[model samples]
Target: MAAGKQVMVIGADDSEESHYALEWTLDHFFKPFGGDTAPFKLIIVHAKPSVSSVVGFVGTGAGVLPIVDADLKKMAARVTEKAKEFCASKSVTDVVVEVMEGDARNVLCEAAERHQASILVVGSHGYGAIKRAFLGSVSDYCAHQAHCSVMIVKKPKTQH
Candidate 1:
């Protein structure tokens, strides 16, 4: 299949699974679509940790520390650098990086909608059914709610 005009590669965090998915999409999916030959854009969307959640739990016996805006900014810079390297290596053109605070699923969906992205690419953290059923997986939620097509990539298991 041909590649989408605008593709949002969500979740460029420090997770190995996310990195794997990002690389895979760039190498296999996007590259095959002609790399820089096509007039397409790659947008990297990262989620910032919730400060309000931390504040809400404060003085309530919750030991969680509020993630400062500076910390989030630093993390976003790293993610942007990694994304740029990935895109440059694959020769992707017109790449952009976006970092925002609040829920991951919500941010991803909103970005996709705003960009009019033809597809959304994300990685699975391999959460178990029990946990996913309770908390819900970001990939699962995006797949269900996103207006565009969604692709969920999982890390390959290593054989012993």
Candidate 2:
């Protein structure tokens, strides 16, 4: 309690795999970090593409900003809400929710740096090695970019 709690910046999005990762992380890491005696800070980080990313397509049309802003804002709020529900369901306390605007990899890394996280955790989308080569993986990018150690959790395969 006296010492500062270590931060674990988690990258989340709107996907079943991401939820699986959250559950996996809570099952494995939460006990060690957020045990009954002491709890470490758990930060849920979600990234929403910035409106500027759409500015070119919108062409600065009238009412465009308002519509885009509302949609983006609502999506971000939903993401954070989902995070909160998940944390509560897991009985996780000492949790922080951050909804950022930008590329997922960049926002997540920036959050880790800002929070001075000891470790960063993200879920693998289960892309094949060949596909991963063609389409860069977020978890891979984060592993390479994050300042601290990274954990990439993959969803368990479902039985037919």
Candidate 3:
């Protein structure tokens, strides 16, 4: 394995599957690559809902527009901080946390391109065949749309 920095973009959200994918990434890639020696330039991406979706909620008042924008910024900061904290706990030092405003599919692919990521990682939510067909899985979309290699990590199903 090349003992050099590799850019990896991971699509994350406030979901159990997203967290599991992070853990899987650390265990499978970072740990096996001799930890900090190879140095992974990780980019954690979280996509917030489209700002247009919340426009009506904020009303057409000009006075509080800045306030609404500030609120959005704060939410992005919180998401970035959470991702940083989680990556730090996993011994991932070189990490960039990004919170983007858009749908997950487009945002994730755009992030990978902007970051020049060598690989993109996403998690499977384990949606059923019918649901996946209709709802469209983010991981599946990333695999098809990402600029680089993609890994779709699925949580193991334990037999009861």
lDDT per residue as tens, model 3, 1-160: 2356778889888778888898899888887766565456778998887555567776777767677777767777776787778777877777778788888899999999987889999989999989999978898888888889999999898899
Pairing residues by index, what is the TM-score of model 1? 0.82
Candidates 1 and 2: which is better by lDDT? 2
The 0-to-1 C-alpha lDDT of every candidate, in the order given, reads 0.78, 0.83, 0.81
Candidate 2 residue lDDT tens string, 56-96: 67688877877898898898888889988888777786688
- Candidate 2 stretches greater than 4 Å from native: 31-39, 55-61, 129-135
Per-model tally of clashing residue pairs: 0, 0, 0
What TM-score do all the candidates reach, one by one?
A: 0.82, 0.85, 0.79
Best candidate, lDDT-wise? 2
lDDT of 1 by residue, 35-73 (tens): 766545678888876766546645434343434545666
Worst 10 residues of 2 by lDDT: 31-40
